[model samples]
Target: MAKLLFGSLAWFSFPSFADNKPLNSPVDYLSVLLSLVVVIALVFMLGYIMRRFNVTQQGGGQMKVVGSMALGTRERILVIQVGEEQHMLGVTAQNINHLAKLDSPLEVAQPSGDNFKDKLTQLMQGQKGKTHD
Candidate 1:
């Protein structure tokens, strides 16, 4: 009787005791792949929305990023134009600090103010021009 009770409990605990087949279903794989694609698409959509509306940038009426340079992964220097005045600011993940107010606003070749992207575009254009020349 004890052995019967133990075997019954074991059968309930161990699924393999009732069914020897493994859980290798095609539907399961398809479901996982669909879920992954949906999640990736959602991330991209959110990013586009944020950039499109400037959702992360508050009080963007007068302030414009004239220039920006990354000091580290999360720290950077930004030159922002407020009306006729341009102010240089030090920005980090934590807070923003006023560095100085520029008498003359720096010339920006690209209005986006991402220095790396602007520089890359310049380098690519230079190389393309050289190839053509």
Candidate 2:
């Protein structure tokens, strides 16, 4: 009775204790191929959906700010304006700081005396202090 109970427990634990089969079987290979095809098809479908939604640009070449990085203890922000978007990345102290100042750029000054980048930074920092979205 003890041997029977132990055998029953062992069987329950080792459910896959059946015939030994090669992992690299034709069925497995076919399944892998099918999965790869499905993934590729899904990727194509996503691209199509993005195009339909206008999330991605249609034309090949558009003015895009490649990289913009900030540095220093002051967290002096460096922003790069692309076609219609801006990017803010992080930079090390070793990186050179080149301020691109456009003279007479703004026709009307901001009431807060801060540019777009400064306002964005302030907003982002404020978000860090509070939990509410």
Candidate 3:
């Protein structure tokens, strides 16, 4: 009786083992591809929804980044305009320091006579001269 019971259990388990075949059908591959595409689209949709709702964004007010300059590898200078006032801030990897609050917002000067590359080269050269002096 024990042998008969074990045989019946083995017979049921055999079909389960046989069902574990590698995915060899085009339909199986298509289903996997479709699932991957769906997951990627869902992630993108979630990011878009969060951005639309300003979920991870800072300062929900009317403050805007007017300009930014990199001072060093880990340091930056930011000019932020809030209403009619502009605030200059020195931001490092360790801390954010308030540099100044301007009474009147500074206007961005338009470059003249040269392209961006020429202006950048001139600026770099000027920095080198200043360092040498």
By TM-score, the best candidate is 1
Runs with alpha carbons beyond 4 Å of true place in candidate 3:
1-61, 108-133
Task: Return the number of clashes found in candidate 2.
Answer: 0
Tens digits of per-residue lDDT for model 3 on 1-133? 9878766756544332337666677766676677679879999999998756546444547887778888887899999988878999999999999999987788854557375566999998888888532
Model-by-model lDDT, in order?
0.75, 0.53, 0.76
Per-residue lDDT of candidate 2, residues 1-133 (tens digit): 9878766756433222223344456666676577679879999999998755546332335543344333445454545444445444444555535455433332322257354556998899998999965
| Superposition TM-score, candidate 1 onto the true structure | 0.45
TM-score for model 2?
Answer: 0.27
lDDT of 3 at 57: 41
The weakest ten consecutive residues by lDDT in model 2 span: 12-21
Query: By TM-score, highest first, what's the ranking?
Result: 1, 3, 2
Steric overlap count per candidate: 0, 0, 0
Question: Please, what is the TM-score per model?
Answer: 0.45, 0.27, 0.37
* Best-to-worst ranking by lDDT: 3, 1, 2
